[model samples]
Target chain A: SQKIEQNSEALNIQEGKTATLTCNYTNYSPAYLQWYRQDPGRGPVFLLLIRENEKEKRKERLKVTFDTTLKQSLFHITASQPADSATYLCALENGSARQLTFGSGTQLTVLP
Target chain B: NAGVTQTPKFRVLKTGQSMTLLCAQDMNHEYMYWYRQDPGMGLRLIHYSVGEGTTAKGEVPDGYNVSRLKKQNFLLGLESAAPSQTSVYFCASSPNGQGPEKLFFGSGTQLSVL
Candidate 1:
C-alpha cells in the first residue's frame, strides 16, 4: 500500500527561526507533490507544488523540495513568524491516478 | 473571486437522516474533489469528479455518493448519516489534470451526526 507520512509531532520554534517539516512516503512513486496550510476551523490553502522532475519550488517565504529518489519531500519556512504557525500538509498524487493522498500533517507553533 | 464555495458551513444531523452538501466553484476547473478530515487523520478522499457529469469513487467512498451535474458544481450525499460520518468536509477544484495543479479549497462544512 502507498503510505504518506509527515511529522506527527508539533514543532515549536522561535519566531525568527526557520521551521522545517518532513514528508516521507513508501511504495508509491507520485508524479507530483503539494503542500497546504490550514488554520483552525478552515480549509487548507494551497502553498507550493513540486513535480517529480523538479528539485525545488518556492513561493514567497515558503519553499518545497522534492526528492523522488529518496521518496521524500521537505517543506521550509524561512524567518518564520507567529502568523506562519499552522498545520502543514504534504500530499502526493497516486501513480497514474487522479487521487491525491495526504499525510497526517505537522503542526508548527511559532512563539514570539 | 469566490473561488470554491460550500454550502452550510455547519450542519448537525441525527443518525439515519439523509443530507446533501453542495459545492460550487467559479474558477472553471475541470476536476473537483470531496474530502473528509478527522482528528489525527489527514484529509481522506471521499469522491471526485474529473469533469461535468463524471463522478468517480475515491479511497473512502463507501458511505458517500457524489454527483457532478454541472461544470462548477459537485454534490456529496450521505444517505444514512452515522456518527462515524461526522467530519469536516472540504471541496477542492483544480484547473486540469496536468502536473501539479494547485487546489482551490472552500472554507469547509462541519457535519455532526448525533
Candidate 2:
C-alpha cells in the first residue's frame, strides 16, 4: 500500500525563525508535489508546487523542495510570523486519474 | 466569484438515515471531487467526477454514492448513515484533468451521525 507521512508531533518556534516541514512517501512515483496551508475551521489553501525535475520552488516567503529519489519533500517558511502558524499538508498525484493523495499534515505554532 | 460552495454547513443525523450533500462550483472546472477529513487521517477521497454525468469511486467510497447531473454540481449521497460517517466533507474543483492542477475548495460541511 502507498503511504504519505508527516510529522505527527506539533512544532513550536519563535516568531521570525524559519519553520521547516517534511513529507515522506513510499510505494509511489509522482511527477508533481504540492503543499497546502489549512487554518482552523477552514478548508486548505494552495501554497506552492514543485515538479520532480525541479529541485526547488519558491513563492514570496515560502519555498518547497522535491527530491523524487528520496521520495520526500520539504516545505519552508522564511521569517515566519504568528499568522503563519497552521497545519501544512503535502500532496502528490495518486495515479493516472490525476487525483491527489495527501499526507497527515504538520502543525506549526509560532510564538511571539 | 464563488469558486466552490457546499450547502448545509452542519448536520446531525441518526443511524440508518439517508442524506445528500450538494456541491456547486462556478469555476467551470472539468473535474470535481468529494473528500472527508478526520482528526488523524488527513483527507481521503470519497468520490469524483471527470465531467457531467460521470462519477467514479475513489480511495474511500464504500458507504457513499455520487451524481454529477450538471457540469457545475456534484451530489454525494449516503444510503444509510453510520457513526463512522461523521466527518467534515469538502468539495473541490480544478480547471482540467490533463495534469496536476491546484484545487479550489469549499468551506466544508460538518456531519455528525449518532
- Which candidate leads in DockQ? 2
Model 1: residues with Cα > 4 Å off, grouped in runs = none
On residues B1-114, what C-alpha lDDT tens digit does candidate 1 reach at each position?
Answer: 899999989999999999999999998999999999998889999999999999988889988999999999999999999999999999999998676678888999999999
The C-alpha stretches of model 2 lying farther than 4 A from their native spots are: none
Considering only the true interface residues, what is the Cα RMSD of candidate 2 after superposition?
0.7
**DockQ each:** 0.78, 0.86
Each candidate's TM vs. the true structure?
0.97, 0.99
Tens digit of per-residue lDDT, candidate 2, span A1-112: 8999999899999999999999999998998999999998788899888888999999999999999989999999999999999999999997778999989899999999
Instruction: Give lDDT per model, in order.
Output: 0.92, 0.94
Q: Could you list the iRMS of every candidate?
A: 1.2, 0.7
